[model samples]
Target: MSATRLTVGWVPLTDVAVLIAAAERGFAAREGLDLVPVREASWANTRDKLVFGHFDAAHMLAPLAVATTLGLGHVALPLVAPFMFNLGGNAVTVSRPLAAALAAHGGLTGDLADAGAALGAVARERLAAGQGPLTFAAVFPFSTHAYQLRLLFLAAGLDPERDVRLVVVPPPFMVDALRRGLVDGFCVGSPWNSVAVDQGVGTILLLGNAIVPRAPEKVLAVPAERAQAPEIAALIRALAAAAAWCATPENRADLAALLAEPRHLDAPAEVVRRTLDGALVIDGAGTVRSDPDFLLLGANRPEPRQADWLADAMVAAGHLPQDAGNAARAVFRADLYDAALAARTRG
Candidate 1:
């Protein structure tokens, strides 16, 4: 019999490692699946393509999945996440001038609260001096990155809505946006932040974990109606196997090289490697910050609490109404994940 072919959409980021590994390392083939991973430039494109049936599944933002299922921003499409791609793989980067301004205020201080206070001070100074608010970019409105930024602002005693401006910039375009002075800073996933740092246009202000420790970042989201399909189960099994492979420290170097291919992230292997290892280059001055929990990828099954957490965050950020109910929490199909892995073991 021929292998089952499935098209999966993804944005170019280190968290897409599992999907890339499954396609490149023969894990999908082992399960009679031919996984075609399509690289997208932005989270919106990925979500739209997936919802429009251009993709069988997608590497999607956890909050976006929740929001989509709840029919918040776009058309109400039932989406379900059976597998989690990763946790905590994002950072905040500020333009060189913004970094200087932050330093003058009080410095980063390696503390999120202290850093937020300093940022609030700078934003206030800018406003008091008749300057516009500092604009920050995030990948998408319904993303952890945006929520993290909100948390940073709240920590600094500033209103995310009124004190500063937040805009959506495609991850790949963040470096250019910073360099061109279109944005003062941005919160984005790996390789992009490193890319900005490498170009000497930005300095890393804080890792995503600093704002929300071990927050669920991306997931393998499929149409809710197709959640029970045999192919989806097989794909889940393949992804589980691939994610385990990606978690092994010995396999990361090869994985990083694979992710750096033109068809994937099309970034430098060293930068991808650094991101996978949680040893990121933060600035042009060669400041390397290492955090083992920076980006975790390994057999992460979707859980209901994670969905609830995202929904709560959406409400907190005013993206979702308080009466939105808990329907979104059902979008995470942990039962499907459990069954798929169990079937794999039985086989």
Candidate 2:
């Protein structure tokens, strides 16, 4: 019998590692799936393509998946996440000048609360001095990166809407945007933050886990109607196998090399490896910070609480109304994930 051919969309980021591994390392093939991993430049393009049927599934932001189902920012199309791609793979980075300003307020203490306090002081001082609000960029309006920024602002006691400027920039362009002074800081996933730090254009101020420990980041989103189809189940099992492979410490070097290919992240293998191992270089001065939970790929099961967290974040970010009850919970098909894995075991 011929394998089922499925087209999946993804942006070039470290978190998309599971999808890439499923395709490149024969996990999908083992499940009788011919996975076609299509690389996209931005999340909006990926979401649009998935919604328009250009993709069977996609590596999607957790919040974007909920927002799409709730029709918060776009046309109402129910999408469901049967498997989570990753958690806690994001970091906040600021330009060198901004870093210096923050240092002057109180050195970058590597603590999220301390950093927020220092940033709050600087933002207020800049406003009093007749300087415009410090600009920051996020990959998308409906992303953990955006929410992390809001959490930072709240910790600093600054209004995200009025005290600081938040804009959308593709992850790949974040470093350049900071370099050109288009934005003073950004919250993005690896290895872009590493790239910025390596180039001396930015400094890593805080990791995403600091704001929301082990926060759900990306998911494998598919049309809600097809959530239980056999092919989708097979895809989920394959991704689970692939994610397990990716989580093995011995396989990280090979995985990093595969992700460094020109068609994928197109970054240095060492940089990618460091990110996978959670030994990140935070600044140009060769400062290394390690955290095992920096990016958790092994535990890929979809959880309802993850959905609840995302919905709460959306509401807090003002992207969704407080009254938007439990609608987002339905978007994460944990039952489907469990069913797929159970079938795999039974078979």
Per-residue lDDT tens digits for candidate 1, residues 291-341, read: 999999984988777777788888999888898747656888899999999
Task: List per-candidate RMSD values in Å.
Answer: 1.1, 0.9
Candidate 2, residue 266: the lDDT equals: 91
| Minimal lDDT window, size 10, model 2 | 104-113
Q: Clashing pairs in model 2?
A: none
Global Cα lDDT for candidate 2: 0.92
How would you encode candidate 2's per-residue C-alpha lDDT over 20-86 as one tens digit per residue?
9999999999999999999999999999999988999999999899888877778878999999999
Each model's TM-score?
0.98, 0.98
Number of the top TM-score candidate: 2
Query: Model 1 scores what on Cα lDDT?
Result: 0.90
Query: For model 1, which pairs clash?
Result: none
